[model samples]
Target: MGKLYGQPDRRPTAHPARPLVVDSQFSTTSVNNRVLVYQVPVNKKRPLLTISGIMSADFLPNVDPQQVMIGPAYAHPEAWVYLPLVNPSNLPRKMIVDLDHNRCDTLDAFLLRGQQRELVHLGTLFRRMPLVQRAIPVRAFALPFELAPHDSAGLLLRSRRSTGIHELTIALSTEKQFTIKRDEEESIRLVALSSAFFFMFTVFSLGLIFKHRLLIYFGLYVFPIGLGQLNYNYFFDAFPFPAWLGLNANSIGLFIIFATNCLFHTFGVAYIKSLNVYGRWHRYAVLFLVGANLIPMGLLLFPLTRTTNAMVTNASLILTTLNIGWLFYISMLGFRVKREKYLLITATLVFVPILYRTYVLDSPALSYSYFQPFYYLLLFGYLIVSLFRRELISQQMTEEKIRLVQGKLEMLRKSEIEQIGRNLHDQLGNTLASALGYLNLKEPRIQVARDMILDAINETRVISHNLVKDDNRPLDEKLEDLAERFNDFSTISFAYSDYTEKRINQLPLLKQQGIYLIVQEVLNNVVKHSQAKEVTIQAFLSEDVVRVSIEDDGIGYTPNQPTSGIGMANMYKRAELARLKLSIDGSVSGTSVTIETPLGG
Candidate 1:
């Protein structure tokens, strides 16, 4: 070996003496061959660095070299390396270099070394980055280089990116192996992303449909988190982004982290705001936290320099600690409650892993967030389940309330019917008996018997009116009772639709009373004159109006025909008194009457 550029000729001290082919059992890919490694400083300025002392390792999925004990520059985003491109065989090799885009932002490689070196911007979102290269799914940047048989050249590589730590990787592989691995990984990622979004959408839609506040808050909190997951995982790098976003890997990551934190705090406050269990002071404290999170979130929008980066990093640690403490505190306050218990478990599961990644694993070679996807997935699933459980609980409580109310109403209804039956038997029955007794007299006391019969008729009418009278019960119930009474007296079938009963009941008592009376008069006419076999009644309430319709399939009467009965006249008088608009349509086959009134009327 001879030195180039007048530098010392030295072999990589850490390189393995023999090539070690890792077995498939311990590997993530089919081929896990060891590759030589080197490191260069961001500020070194020189094209290559002294690489004889760097650490090295075999290509294994679960193992990596220990962190290099180096100077401060080792943690900088601009990382450089020198790969000794060697072809020991007689045949030439077209080798592919793969970098996990999640680990870094931009990748650049130089062919040859010294004066003859040519620069290649392999992994980047800039205009210069090749469109075809952007299509690769797994690697952040895949750079290809060629070497003649039994020849070698120094390939210099740089990664201008960082994922909170100085870690970066340069994986070596044959072209065919790289393609197969990329496709397999791509399919898996698409499925995972699709499922995650689908779950998110489901929870969000439920929140809207049911109007569950906690689910709504949870949905809002998780949206940005999902986006941040994609951003940090390098999923977005597969597509081209507009330059106007002013984002590289690091800045975008910071922005997303800050935004997610802000939203989490905001939603956290909203979730607990109405819970009296947290107390007034705790609510105020949470509000303060939301305001506090906004400070860091706002600062991140400005141009980022080293000062901003350091500030943000320190802030993140402090804010994350506070967030965890808040979760624990809430769990303690509502420890007996199911929702708070879930929060406690979730916090406990996530807290330790984040601490381990942030503090214990301080290496540039290993991922700063190896367990990120797992923990975040855990959080997402747990939150959705918690919200659904809460909704189900609410529904159960509502149903219980309805059952209680219905039970009371049933008892009251039975009592009223019993009272009405006694009145009919005691009062009306006695009056009719007296009238019959008067007729039984030989001379018949004709006038006295007639007066007794009239008194009995009046008493029966009053009893019948009382049965369908409105009091504490709903207007629809009163109308339904009226229809049932009419059905008992005649052969006609009566149907009533109260689909908008809830809305109709919201109107003033006076309006409901007027509506009930008008409907009563119309039904009487259908029975007396229309000779209807079937009758249908429908009521609807809109934003500012109420409408009710009654139709009968019968031998209808002419509108202009003279009638001795006053039923039609009574309907018109009642509608006019209530300030309602009334319309009557009659044909040989049927008669329809509709009443419309403004809500205020």
Candidate 2:
């Protein structure tokens, strides 16, 4: 027989509402197959003892009466009943039975001999049953049984003592050996979805590291919402966790939703501000809300921390309201700023469904799954517009800088032309006039001297003409002119080939002049020092580049040998001005100077 204990009641004399009272009872029974079930019934509730029941061995219609024996009672009218049954004969036949709701609250089958009343708690249920006479404790709110001819006997459930109506129903059974477990399909799907979410989040994070704004925002704000939806569905539909964990499908969903929304708020502010739109007050509000949510998240990590469930719920509701309000505010601001109407409209449309699902509608049809993809799409559209705006602004700035530089270059070019004209008029003209005057004097002995003076005047005239003419022309034409003039002094042979005429025609004037001057210097060196039989000038033009090679089969000088000369230095300076790549190779066979320039066009 079970005993009962009473404790002093503490309560206010007058109460605003009626208090609920609970009464509970326990009994046990054993069937022929060595199965024991201790059934407890709490005051008449259909969902009995709140602890899941255990299976009996005989495949009885109800809790077996013969194997049951009464044990001790606890402090609050709680009772313990024991039922013991062995294996072997208990199996080979699957049994289905239903228990009376009013009598049996919960059933706990156990193998231990000692009874401890203090062990019974509201949230914990314990059961012990034997499999092939081997005892094991099963702890859960509910348990399913599959007993075979050769299998061991095990307890089906453990129940906490409580006053409620508990009814038992056999959920499933099969003659064929249990091949596949229940919830397996749903578990696999949930895992697959979780893995996908993890991958997408990782990708988003990497994109953020690289400063990809679209992917960053997508991962930060959008992907989490999808993950939240998946979590909500997964927890509710399959693989339900412990109630003590305080992580229900709804709680996880709300947490993810609020957190992701907070991120969106932050990113949105920055995104708008970058577009020269103001979002100051909204940003501050979002920051405050984010702080509030973070406190709850921190608290959740510790084991057995008293959950501020109401606070978390309230915070979630507030955040959702604030997010909706901010969305509307941003839409108004977008209108004032004349932002992209389609993007604004799309965002508004997307938000409407989420808002409706969250607040106005309770149906699963209005779930987050329907709206998440659309939200990401709207975000992508906004990102594209932002990128286009940035690119346009950058292009305008570049154009302005180019125009300023072009103006300065034009001024410099005009000044250079004016300076060159003055130098020619003041110096070369005076020298040529004096030479002409000397040539005009008549005398037989002085005639030879006069001829020499006339030749000098002619040479000076040609030089003056070249100095004044536009230096922009084909490099070959310039080099050919130099070779012709040099031929007047010494016999010159030129061999030029393997270059496209079309490319030569496209050389910029400045680059052409630089190459011409370099060739002229090389020819002058050949005349002054190299007693050569032939000279070879080759010019080649490739896409966006020009190469000129001038070679003479004459005495070559080693570059390492010391010399006091400005000719090579001047050639290098001309190359720098034209931005030409120059290389000179000299050997006993010949000396070759190669000048290369990249065509700007």
Task: Report the Cα lDDT for residue 454, model 1.
Answer: 78
Stretches > 4 Å off in candidate 1:
1-75, 83-87, 111-130, 133-139, 147-155, 162-166, 232-250, 270-275, 337-340, 361-375, 382-387, 390-394, 409-601
Which sections of candidate 2 miss by over 4 Å?
1-215, 226-254, 302-307, 361-601
Which residue pairs in candidate 1 collide? 101-140, 167-364
Per-residue CA lDDT of model 1 for 4-56, tens digit only, reads 10112223345432332222222222111233433334454433333322233
Residue-by-residue lDDT tens digits, candidate 2, 82-137: 22212344335342211211112344443221122112222222222222222212
Estimate TM-scores for all models: 0.54, 0.34
Deviation from native of the Cα of residue 365 in model 1, angstroms: 13
Per-structure clash totals for the candidates = 2, 25
